[model samples]
Target: MPTILHRRWLVGGAALLILLALTAGYIFLTTAATAPARARIQAAASMRPFGEVDQEVVNARTLVEDTPESARAWSVLGLAYLQLARETADPTNYGRADEAFQRALDLDAASVDALIGAGTLALARHEFAEALELGTRAMELNPTIPRVYGVIADAQVELGRYEEAVASVQTMVDLRPDLASYSRVAYLREIHGDNQGAIDALELAVSAGGPAAENTEYVRVQLGHLYFATGDLARAEQIYGESLARLPEYIPALDGLARVRAARGEYSEAIELYEQASARIPLPGTIIALGETYEAAGDQGRATDEYQLVEAIQLLFEANGVRSDVELAAFSAAHGDDADRALALARDAHVRLPTIFAADVLAWSLYRTGAIAEAAGVADEALRLGTQNSVMLYHGGVIAAADGDTDTARTRLEAALDLNPRFSPLLADRAAAALAALDN
Candidate 1:
């Protein structure tokens, strides 16, 4: 937990101290920017993965300096800073983005570009209500823009307004049936228990291409994740490999392949890929996966180190005004440590953003803290949409078992294994064991 010890755990000898933040925001291609702004970003950014946005940021800054009075230039700079923040996982970039957007708004209060930029930044920062307001304003300014609907739909989804989110996504798709819209459709379908429908839409996204190579590859990673969720390890591995071939060492692809390897019990390979990914961006999810892989491989010491790093990173993000309460709560519940803390964090998250994910975490945390009846009730709400998420089903099964509902417990547990036998690197075997005990 000391500074020196943290330094020792750095992947590939990099400092790895600051949270290279993972983006939890929805995806947008941003194809509606001004010609100069788009050209500058596309030329400087090119097809080189989203994690490398330094050149794009530099180009945007130069343009801003060249045309200091142009609100569009300032908006582009703001967007560039926002992209840099997302790719680098550095919350400090968010501050720079905020300043640039404010400057743009000051110059032109009706700048849709600035509004969209600021709205997307809010999404990245997990301020769903603020993002919704900004997106709505942008939509009112230009209802025909697909990206505006993307922002609105993303915020609505996080705010637990599923029907509204669906309508927004439909509008986006009707306006522009491209990678961004199709991908959103895929997510909505997946969450609504239509796995095959999700896959079909993702395939459309893959074929539709994207604004950048990374965008296409990100969709591939998502496709791979869908397969991975269904226990189709072979297909998932193949898609991940294809993505890597297109964009070598793409973080999400590496993470996906690592997950496949872990599911297949190839811990060394999984750890190596995860190390590569965490070295580049250090997403909290990837770090946790690496830690869980280490734990699976019988390296408890290293696993503990990774877990400690996650805690440190979460604390750092909090200090920077990014709320990671749900993530932290899930981590605590999974690790079976500090159940009370997990419950409180989950409660806070559910109150702020009542998404199904928040509901699931809250339910799990409640179960961890021994509030079985409340946990069961909340778990039902988590699955109210009939989402086929194995982990949520697993949680429901466990909670039902605790409440002595043998039939429901058996049905839920069976459904979870049917969906994905290896739904979690750390918990899948436990689920099997629990199911076996119930049978006996």
Candidate 2:
């Protein structure tokens, strides 16, 4: 037990012990401002593959060319590009989307689709203020639109307005019970500590969004993730396999399957799956997981190699005008020994998003920086949702212990183990050791 509870992060074992208390909370997204809107358009955040949804884009383009002044067609094109941007993780697609949406607005100053499209793009780009403005305006223009509620809900959660988010999603579901509404409901349910409710809602979404293409594959992977979080590896694996069966080489499903492998102590297999996932996405998180699993298997050299890739990726993302603070903060916190760097990255991330994920990293980073008092406050905030994140609980527990709150510390550490004892090969043992010390 040491500073930041890395199992080996040994700046101050005594301080880590003292900080090992307190817990509970959710993991909600962050953005700001609230606008209520209602209109009759299906949720458009499917984020399908470019090839699969290229037809819609082409059709929209054709319509615009044939009818140059058609705001509807222009809005459709904008939305298409927005989805493409998300699917491809390409920033340029956002610019194209913005242009199309602006054209729609120019042609029809009051086009609700254009407004919603713009708002969606803003949400994607982390422009919470603009997203809120557009969401509110779209709502006023068409109060019955379900997608408006989604946009409003996303914005509200980012702004730390959980109450409004709940109400917005409620209105969305009440309007129509579809894939989008149900998925939001599921995430909100998880945030509220209703794992079963979240699972049930996703089940509904899976059933509602069948046919096994992009949407179904994505939902199934998410369902697998929930299952993994709850320590149901068998069911999670089944879901992931089914998803992969539907969409061979689906990266998310591959990642989920890899996680299941890691949990089951299938180290080599896990590494293979994770490597495949890395080949597919090259996301920092995937690389970090690969390294962590390698560490779990005692492959220290390989782990170091993977950890080194993080800085290069960060540099690349920066060069492309993408900060990606959340992932960077997480990567630094997990892999870097310099607590100062982790704290700096986490502080910036919290300022940018303020989501529970950011809050958790900030709390841990504060702990790493020896700001035990500050860490306690942010750790408390991180647990505001009663989330089942074992790492978050472990951090809160350790912080509480450091603060001399033995009861709170014990409870949190116990909860972390109960939620998922194997959450981190590194931290799980540390959590166990901390609990044993508390017992002594």
Candidate 3:
């Protein structure tokens, strides 16, 4: 009886040992299966919004090669490439982003996120037609998706369909109510002569909360521009200062602030800002601002240097197959009386662009050269565009007065004053004098 009891105990011990071994094997297999997924998740979490995350995402792309079916991996790749494109502005980065987005689309053809990214790339390239098509298709594929409408709105705006752009942006606001959409709507309103509407839209944009840090800074800069355009120089200065506080190197804000200072007759302050902006982006606009400010400060030599720099920039753009006729004409007209070189440039530029503003410049340049009859014809063409721009109206008034058409000159000059009495004190004073002479 003792032997039989000992054998039963041994059998039970063996069974318990087998059960323990099986449980250990199951745990090992489960952990091994989950290890790769955990690694992928960790890698994704390490990706930042706009910095080193771009490189990390590129590295993650290699790891996901074996997991081509991973939709989330493709999505991460797309986002990383998009951010890289935004930071670098290298069109090649946009091309890479497009491939990444295409990969995401391949993984999930109905991916609204991928569609939006692709659409944004098209928009950035100024391929407005393609952007509109892609954005519309994306929206049709998924109406509830965010940001697609914003892309469409931007495309429409570039195409000069302002009303349609506004409607599309409004829909985006209803769908996502984000800052990007709101800001775009504000720009459209501002262009449509609704300053108050622009301010209201921008205020909503400020409150909309979804703006990324860079986007928030940009929106503030845009607000400064809106204020400047509406003649609120003080408010413009304040907004630009706020943006510079957030992003000290923001060129657009710096330029706007400089313009405000120049308008307020603070030439020294304006020059400093213009120099900073010029160092960053030596475009024609910045150079012209700097030249004008220097001239205002009675620094003739410095102003000449700035104008020469502008001429060099124009030559560079022309070499690159990008025309700056309008800018050249305006520059020429501004300094034609004192610079023979400027008058020659104005005539050539006016012949190229042939826009109303260009015509006005050509007319002014001709008038400086004692070519009143030629100036009169070009000025008449300029008025035919019916822009109602105060500067253009003032130019028409000047041309009419030069041609001895007192009635027409008074009409145009009065129109210019009614549009903006403070358009330019010099121009306004001239208009007032011309009208007084007509009355006499």
Per-residue lDDT over 1-440 for candidate 2, one digit per residue giving the tens place of the 0 to 100 score: 12111112111000000100000011111222101000000111233344766776788889889989899989989977765554444445677888999999999988999998888777665566678889899999998988787788777776667778777777776777777777777777777776766777777777777332666667767788888888788899999999888878777788888888887789899999988766645555677889989999999999987787655555544544554666679878877889898999999989878888889999988988889899989999999988877888899999988878899899999998887777776788899999888878
Q: What local lDDT does model 2 show for residue 407?
A: 95
Look at candidate 1 and give me any clashing residue pairs: 20-89, 21-89
Evaluate residue 136 in candidate 2 and report its C-alpha lDDT on the 0 to 100 scale.
91
Worst 10 residues of 3 by lDDT: 13-22
Among all windows of 10 consecutive residues in model 1, the one with the lowest summed lDDT is 9-18
TM-score, one value per model: 0.88, 0.84, 0.62
Ranking by TM-score: 1, 2, 3
Global fold similarity of model 1 (TM-score)? 0.88
Give the least accurate 10-residue stretch of model 2, judged by summed lDDT.
Answer: 12-21
Supply the global lDDT for candidate 2.
0.72
The CA root-mean-square deviation of candidate 2, after full C-alpha superposition on the true structure, stands at 12.0
Off by over 4 Å in 3: 1-92, 95-99, 102-110, 281-284, 295-440
lDDT over C-alpha atoms for residue 72 of model 3: 61
Candidate 3, after superposition: displacement of residue 392 in Å?
A: 6.8
Better of 1 and 2 by lDDT: 1
Better of 2 and 3 by TM-score: 2
Q: Per-residue CA lDDT of candidate 3, range 241-276, in tens? A: 888887676666888888887767778998999987
